[model samples]
Target chain A: DAGVTQSPTHLIKTRGQQVTLRCSPKSGHDTVSWYQQALGQGPQFIFQYYEEEERQRGNFPDRFSGHQFPNYSSELNVNALLLGDSALYLCASSLDRLAAYNEQFFGPGTRLTVL
Target chain B: AQSVTQLDSQVPVFEEAPVELRCNYSSSVSVYLFWYVQYPNQGLQLLLKYLSGSTLVESINGFEAEFNKSQTSFHLRKPSVHISDTAEYFCAVHETSGSRLTFGEGTQLTVNP
Candidate 1:
């Protein structure tokens, strides 16, 4: 069984440009969450998707948006990127919310570099 | 709101030595604690998690963590270390109501041979 997978393993963009990172959840999982990890910091939650809708969001701005397809895949879109936006975007997948535990499987992540 | 604090920024231990990485969290309600390992320039991998049941949880890779509710701490420990164990270990917490995880500063565990 494949674990969570992400596309465009690395990307380069300029200021004010937009970028979209894609993620596929683990097999048999239906929940996807996005996180940002800066150069020397731990991952920070951006948002979570469930039932094809955003269930929870972090303290991110409107420029950070996401979509969850019916197939349980998810996309993270960051608009008006700044130099600070250059970081590793991580996606994690887990079983349904009703599960007894919250064990999340993470993808290799997309490294977005804004110049 | 929930937050995690990793006291040590880096920990160095020789091979076959026992090592411990400290973690503490602040939350009002019950929480699910987790430890994730991230190699250089890689994604986070679940080391182990403490959801319920016994307070102590072990990973197949010789790492273990004990969840102390009263202390709001979930510290990772290993009896013997290997060179391959060098990585950044992160501590995170999730509220029972949702899956949002708040991560710590991360501890860089350096195993010296």
Candidate 2:
């Protein structure tokens, strides 16, 4: 089966501008979560979407938001981006949002560059 | 809250040599642990996980890790390494009551000939 997929392999945006990154979860998965991996750092959880609603969120600010469509696809939107926003955005899908035992499959990720 | 710490930022070793990457975590509640590997220009891939049961876990590859609850550590090791084994390794923790995963800064392993 195909694994999780993300769109726009790479993106470049200027400060104060907005950007949206898309993600299609792995087949047979429903929950989607977003993460940010800065240079030389591990990924930090952004938020998770389940049942078309945000189920859990990390310490990120309000400027970072996400949506989960009925088809289990997801979109991560970052508004008023700053230079520090440049990072690799990863999307992961799991069988259930609340099941701790369920493993999360990740996508190749979208590299965002804030210029 | 849960957090993970990968002790080594970079580890260099000769091919066929043994290697060890250290990881430690802190959590107030029961948590599941995981190790992920990322190659150049790639996303994170699950290496192995420690949900419960035996303290030692092995991956399809030669990699294996032992979970020490008292020490709150899960260190990854391989008896022999290859050039293709070079990659970035991350340690993560997921609290049983929470959905988010907290990851470490990552360890870059370079297996050279």
Candidate 3:
């Protein structure tokens, strides 16, 4: 089975610009979540998408938004990026969005560099 | 809200030596704990998880962790380490009523020969 896959393995964006990172969830998975891992830090949950709705969200600002397509793929968009926006963006897939017991599979992650 | 703290930012060990990485969490509700490993330039991978039934969980690579409910800790340990075992280790918690995982700052394990 194919694991979760993310596009634009790496991206470079300037301040005030917006960027979109894509993700295809693992095979047979239904839910997609986004996370941001800054240098020397662990990942922080951005938001989760289930049934094409934002099921749950972390303490991130409004500039960080995401969408889950009908096919279970996802896109994380960051608008008016700042230098601190530079980090590794990860996408994780699970069997169900609200199921606690379901394990999550992660993609290789897209490294975003805000210049 | 839930959060995790990995006590060690970096741990260096010789090959074949034992090592322990400490983790602590804070939550108002019962949580399912997890440890994820991330190699250089890679996404986090599940090491093992503790949901219920067993206070201790083991991975295929000789890594094990014991969940202490009273202490709110899930510390990862390995009896013997190898070079390939070097990676970034993250401790995370998922509240039973929540969908997102709250993660720690991560501990970098460097196993040297």
Kindly list the per-residue Cα lDDT of model 1 for residues B1-113, writing each as its tens digit.
Answer: 98999999999999999999999999887889999999987889989998889999999999999999878899999999999999999999988877789999899999998
For candidate 2, the TM-score is 0.98
DockQ of 2: 0.87
Cα shift from native, residue A76, model 3 (Å): 0.7
Off by over 4 Å in 3: none
Task: At residue A55, give the lDDT of candidate 1.
Answer: 93
Stretches off by above 4 angstroms in model 2 are none
Could you say which candidate leads in lDDT?
Answer: 2
Query: Per the 3 Å backbone cut-off, how many clashing residue pairs does candidate 3 have?
Result: 0
* Native interface contact recovery, all models: 0.69, 0.86, 0.88
TM-score on alpha carbons, each prediction: 0.97, 0.98, 0.98
Give a tens-digit lDDT track for model 1, residues A2-60.
98999999999999999999999999999999999988898999999999999999999
Pairs clashing in candidate 1? none
- Clash tally for model 2: 0
Candidates 1 and 2: which is better by lDDT? Answer: 2
Candidate 2 lDDT tens digits, B19-87: 999999999999999999999999999999999999999999999999999999999999999999999
Query: If both were scored by DockQ, which would come out higher, candidate 2 or candidate 3?
Result: 3
lDDT of candidate 1 vs native? Answer: 0.93
> What's the TM-score of candidate 2 when only chain A is evaluated?
0.97
